[model samples]
Target: MADLDHSSDDTSVDSREESSQDSKLEFSEDEETLVALMYNLIGERWSLIAGRIPGRTAEEIEKYWTSRYSTVSE
Candidate 1:
């Protein structure tokens, strides 16, 4: 019988799952509206827009916008 090593593959899959879970943040309707307003006013300057949103970073805001609103708006 031959044994195959799958520990490395399992670790990589777990890390990817963790990252995906971390990225799945939820925004309230008010927050979404505010983000949309800021996006419309300032364009894609995520850093600048992030300042207006409390508890959210530029990267998070940018990711959310790109994933949720970019296609809809365009």
Candidate 2:
């Protein structure tokens, strides 16, 4: 455990900011379903998807969808 350095090594940020960032990264069930529906409709238009779901960015949405759906070859 002494070798691990998960916390800030040199910089510090407010807890509220950390929590808000954490919240943005998390995807609730409803959000997931919405992402799926929107994906079916728009087909990888990440900016549009992010527009439908506030607080989430296209980059994160793309990352989440790929992570959730990716397997073996894809």
Candidate 3:
């Protein structure tokens, strides 16, 4: 109760760099190229690429490409 005066106003920040310990990368240049090639080769059948690339889902890949198109057009 005695130190309650400064308790609310005291600010502390813990800073630490966050590094991803992920073994798999989401989108590398090579992966992008391969995804594109797979898309063309399969034509909307993203499962082919998703199956080859670990930790990648066909739905997420499609969403990413769709978002890219929207961003580029805008």
Pitting candidate 1 against candidate 2, the one with the higher TM-score is 2
C-alpha TM-scores of all predictions: 0.63, 0.65, 0.53
Candidate 2 clashing pairs, residues 3+ apart or interchain: none
Decide which is better by lDDT, 1 or 2: 2
Model 3 lDDT per residue over 1-74, tens place: 75775564453211111222122334788778877888778877767778877778877677656654455642
Clash counts per candidate, in order, are 0, 0, 0
Candidate 2: deviation at residue 7, Å?
A: 13
Clashes of 1: 0
Report the Cα lDDT for residue 23, model 1: 58
Ranking by lDDT: 2, 1, 3
Clashing pairs in 3: none
What tens-digit string does per-residue lDDT give for candidate 1 at 1-74? Answer: 12235777778899998886575457789878988998888899989988988888888888888788656753
Whole-model lDDT values for every prediction: 0.80, 0.82, 0.63
Worst 10 residues of 2 by lDDT: 2-11
**Stretches > 4 Å off in candidate 3:** 1-26, 70-74
